[model samples]
Every structure is written in C-alpha cells, then in structure tokens.
Target: MKIAILGTGAVGTTIASRLVEIGHQVMIGSRSKTNEKAIEFVQKFDRNISNGTFEEAANFGDIIFNCIKGEFAVGALKSIEKIIDNKILIDVSIPVNTKNGMPFTLIPELCNTNSLGEEIQKNLPNTKVVKTLNTMWSTLMMTPSMLKDGDHTNFICGNDTEAKETVKILLKEIGWKEESIMDLGDITGSRGMESVLHLWWKIWGSTIGTFSIKVVN
Candidate 1:
C-alpha cells in the first residue's frame, strides 16, 4: 500500500518507518520541500521513504495519514485539497495546548475537542475520514511489544461503514487484530477518543509505562 504521512513530526516519522519496514511505499510530506536534513532522515530510516511537498505526498498515497498539529491541520490540508476527496484519511490529531510538557484537550462549542477529525470530514465532505491512533502515544503506534501489562486499547470512530471497514483492514495490517480494536462508531464518537488521551497519559506516567491495553473476554 502506498501510504503518505503528512507533518514529518514524531508521529509521522514513526508511522512512516513502521510502514516501510513491513514492505509498503511510504512518503513524508512536509511544509518544506525535501531538504538535505529530510533526505538524510528518510534515507537513514528506510530506503522506501520519499519526501515531498504536501500536494505531492497527498496524491502519492493511497491513504493519507494526517499527523499535523491540530492548529495547523486545516491549512495544511487545504494546501492539498484536490486529492483528498473520496480518499480514506486516518486522522491522528487532537486539539492540544502543549504547555509545560503536557497537552490539555480544548473544548469546542459543538464537537468537543475531537471534531478536527470530523471537521476535516465535514470540510472535505467527499473524504472518508476515520478517527484512530489518537488515543495512544506514537511510541506504541507501530511497536506493540512495548505494551506494558499488555492491556491497552486503540479506539476508532467514523460515520461511513465502508470507510470504517477500510480502516480496520489497515489497522490489521499494522498488527491490530479485529477484536483487540474497539469501534466507537460515527465521527462524533471521536470525543471519547480525545478523553482516552488523558487515560493514556496517566497510564504512561504511572506503573504501566509504555505498554498497551488489549480487551480480552
């Protein structure tokens, strides 16, 4: 699968490396065109990684992972508006106010803090946006081995049935089993995911450390 990760930050870098490791064409799209540093990072990480401008990466990916900071997400997306429609976009963003090494979720009038995922869906209208990978830290996004107590959950929510299934398939490809993943349902359900970030942080800071949660019956 050709996967495009926007933003080139920690989350983007982690996801890109994971996808590349298991044999996928991965590209990193940044605000800046591929610079020497970007080239070096990608080359060092994996030979499969291609760095490009926003529009280039959007069009290059079969599925685009929007990993930009929430504040800049809208504009960053708008820059590549043409290719977004009808594509499956997995939004891993949260509205965060990072002060003193902590991020607090913002309160939105209608949609709460998680609406950025749905908001992107609403604005794009044609894109199939599934909200996932926002609950846990990027550390566990790819490597499930670090999961402490081995009991953690990654939540997904979306409106479209087909889109949700598509996302589930992708998640499975990344080693998330169907039962281990919880489908919260509908884009509005993303609010719960944002709240889980609080739980995730607390767990990370506590005894659990970098482990994950799995729902077992």
Candidate 2:
C-alpha cells in the first residue's frame, strides 16, 4: 500500500519508518519538500520511503496519515483537501498549547463542543477521517508490545464504518490487538478521545515509563 504521512515530527517519522519496515511504500510530507528533517528522514529509511511537500504526498498516497501538529493540522490539510478526496485519512493529532516548550493545555477553541478530528472531517468532507493513536506516545503508537505485550487498549472513531475498519486493519498490522481496540461510535467521540490527553499528560509525569489504559470488566 502507498501511504502518506503529513508531518515531519516524531509521530510521522516513526510511523513512516514502521510502514516501510512492513513493506509498504511510504512518503513523509511536510510544509516544504526541502525540510531538513524530512530529508534526513528519507535518507535514514529504505528506498521504499520518500519525502515531499504536503500536496505532493497527498497526491502520491493511497492512504493519508495526518500527523501534523494540532495547531497547524486543519489549515495544512485544507490547503490540499481536494487532492486527498475519497482517501482514508487517519488523524492522530490533538490541538495542544505548548507553554515554555511543554504541552500545558489543549486548545481552548477546540474542546468540549468541538475537536480536531471533527474539524478535519468538516474541512475535507469527501475524505474519510478516522481518529486514533493521539492518546499515547509516538513510539507506543507503533510498537504496542512495549507495554503488556500489546494488550493495552487503543481507541478509534469515525463517521464512516468502512473507513474505521480499514484503519483497524492497519492497527493490527502495526501490533495492536483486535480485541483491545474500542470503537467509540463516531467522529464526535473524538471529543473524549482528545480530551483524555489531559489525564494522559498527568499520568505521564508521574510514571517511570510509558503507560496506557485497558478497559476490563
């Protein structure tokens, strides 16, 4: 499969590397094709992976992963909305306010009543947007075995059932367990999913290493 990762950040790079390792053709996208980080990433990966501008990646990919920072995600995706129409877009970004280089708060305008997932879906109406993987660290997103041998839970929500199923397949390929993944109904569930970051960050500070939750009866 051809995959486009729309960011040069740790999350995007980590996912791009994993996809390439799993034999998928991957493209890392950024604000510009000349971005030093994206270039470095391509150099470090196999020939199956490449780098390009966001628009170019969108056109090149069969599936698009929106890993752009929450603050910039909507605007960046909106710029190439038409190029990604009808493609499955997996959004793993949450709007965060970094104060003194630390993520201190979720964006005020995008909480409770609205969410980044909804915004992306609203802006790219023709694209199928599935929200997942925003609640944990980037490394954990790709290698769930780091915790409980991949037993920890992951969440996914989207308006399109077929799109969500497609994402679930990718999740399994990347080490997530089918029984461990919970479907929170639709894109509106992203509110709670993104909001959970509040608790995630708090737990992160006190924990010795990475941690995630599992729902059990």
Candidate 3:
C-alpha cells in the first residue's frame, strides 16, 4: 500500500518508518520539499520510503495518514484537498495546545461538542476518515506488545463501515488484535476518545510510565 504521512514530526516519522519496515511504500509529507527532518527520514530508510511537500505526498498515496499536530491538521489537509478526495484517511492526531510552557492541553473550542476527527471529516467531506491511535504515544501506536502482555485496548470510530474495517486490518498488522480494538460506533464517538487524552496526560505525568487503556468486560 502507498501511504502518505502528513507530518514530519515524531509521530509521523515513527509511523512512516514502521510502515516502510512492513514493506509498504511511504512518503513523509511536510510543508516544504526540503524539510530537514523529512530529508533525513528518507536518507535513513530504504528506497520505498520518500519525502515530499504536502500536496505531492497526498497525490502519491493510496491511503493518507493525518499525523500532523491537532491544531494544524485542518489547514494542512485543506492545502491538498483536491488530491485526497475518496482516499481513506487514518487520523491519529489530537487537538492539543501548549500554554505558557505548560503540559499539553486540548483546545477548548474543539473538544466535547467537536473533535479533531470530526473537524477533518467535515472539512474534507469526500474523504473517508477513520479515527484511531490518538489515545496513545506514537511508539505504542505500532508496538503495543512492548507493554506488559499487550492486553491493553485501542478505540476506533468512523462513519464509513468499510473504511473502519480497512483500518482494522492495518491495526492488526501493527500488533493490535481484533479483541483489543473497540469500535465506538460512528465519528461522533471520537468525542469520548479525544476527551480521554485529558486523563491520559494526567496518567502519564503521575506514573511517568508508558501505558494504555483496556476495556474490561
């Protein structure tokens, strides 16, 4: 599969490297074609991995991974809206803002009633958007098994049933089991998932450890 990762940050680079390791074609998309981080990523990986501007990467991918920071996501996608039509977009971003050097915080206007996932979906009505992996760190996003026993849970939500199923397969490839993945109905459910980040931040600070949630029956 040809995948486009729309950010050159830690999350996007980590996801792109993993996908490339798994034999998928990956392009790290950034605002500039000469982005130093993006260039370094391609030089570090095999020929199957590359880098480009946002629009160029969008045009190159069969599936687009919106890995940009939550606050910048909509504007980034809008820049390449024409090329991403009908593509399945796996959104793993959270709408977080940092204030006065404080720990990460969610944007008040985009939480509860609205979420980054829904906003992206609304902005790109023609794109198939599925939300997942926003609740955990980028490393854990692909290697959940690194944690003790890997029994933790992850959530996904999207209006398109088919798109969700497709994302499920990709999740499995990265070590998520069917039983460990919870589908919380449609896109609206993202509100709950996004909200979980607040608690997640607190937990991360309290324990100073890597952890994720598990849905116990």
> Could you say which candidate leads in lDDT?
2
Task: Report the Cα lDDT for candidate 2.
Answer: 0.91
Winner by lDDT between candidate 3 and candidate 2: 2
> For model 3, what is the error of residue 73's alpha carbon versus the real structure, in angstroms, after optimal superposition?
0.7
Which ranges of candidate 3 are over 4 A from the true structure? none
lDDT, residue 54, candidate 1: 78
TM-score, prediction 2: 0.97
User: lDDT by residue for model 2 over 14-126, one digit each (tens)?
Assistant: 99989998889998899988999999879986489999999999999999999999999999999998999999999999888664366667888788999999989999999
Per-residue alpha-carbon lDDT of candidate 3 for residues 1-217, written as tens digits (9 for 90 to 100): 9999999989998999889888899988999999998998799964799899999999999999999988899998987888999999999988886552466677887888899899999999999999999899989988988886678889999999999999999999888888889999899878988888779878888886788989899
Question: C-alpha displacement of 96 in model 2, angstroms?
Answer: 0.3
Candidate 3 displacement at residue 178 in angstroms: 0.9
The C-alpha stretches of model 2 lying farther than 4 A from their native spots are 99-103
Q: How close is candidate 1 to the true structure, as a TM-score?
A: 0.88
Worst 10 residues of 3 by lDDT: 97-106
Q: After superposition, how far is residue 135 of candidate 2 from its true place, in Å?
A: 0.8
